[model samples]
Target: MPELENNFYNKNLKPLARNMRNDSTKAEIRLWCEILSGKRMLGYGFRRQRPVGNYIADFLCKELMLIVEVDGYSHNFKMEEDVKRDAQLQALGFTTLRFSDREVMQDIENVWRTLEFWIFEGENSLS
Candidate 1:
């Protein structure tokens, strides 16, 4: 049935994998998991490379419309592309936040604090 197939397809949309193999995105993910384990994270789950519109975002919480990007050395070569994608996401009512790999790895606590505050700010603004 078409309905059954649709349901099955939706169920298969697993955003992130737990045990990352050769992903260069692992460091940011590990730091995020540590932050999440500490209850520093809010409604947004750490979704690795979630596809939104035509862009594949690093981490996106669909419910909150919040996108988190952990920029690495590679991103330096794609600033213009990133900016265009970010503009499209913003137009779709999503707020994008970016943190560098060094920032997340060397200053994790601050990253957590900033992420928490942003999430809370989103919540508070809604009411």
Candidate 2:
């Protein structure tokens, strides 16, 4: 993973990211508490509401150069923005995986399985 530099850090966005962390959405809270927090996922670490470049990633794993986005209803109208955000993250050497609120809220186990496969296996194959 590329080291984060001053150019990538936007001071203004930190506060927003911190605020989002404190007042997390239901799906974000659930995903964090249940699956991603506490150095989980084969010892990989994840940060919630992490500021990456100009956008804040829902969940970021620096070691794996991965960003997991948990999309809610608002995302329905933001396909173009999401595509741009993914491209920006990809330019910074991160691959993003997006999941829906219903998927996370209803079948988190399958989400976990997909994440596990992506992180530990699929990413390697892609490389």
lDDT scores in order: 0.69, 0.87
* Residue-by-residue lDDT tens digits, candidate 2, 39-95: 878788998888889999999888788899999999999999999999998998889
lDDT of 1 by residue, 35-61 (tens): 643444764555555556666666666
Candidate 1 Cα lDDT to native? 0.69
Give the TM-score (vs. native) of candidate 1.
Answer: 0.73
Residue clash pairs of candidate 1: none
lDDT of 1 at 87: 93
Kindly report the root-mean-square deviation of model 1 from the true structure over all alpha carbons. 5.3
Model 1 residue 67 distance off true place after TM-score fit, in angstroms: 0.6
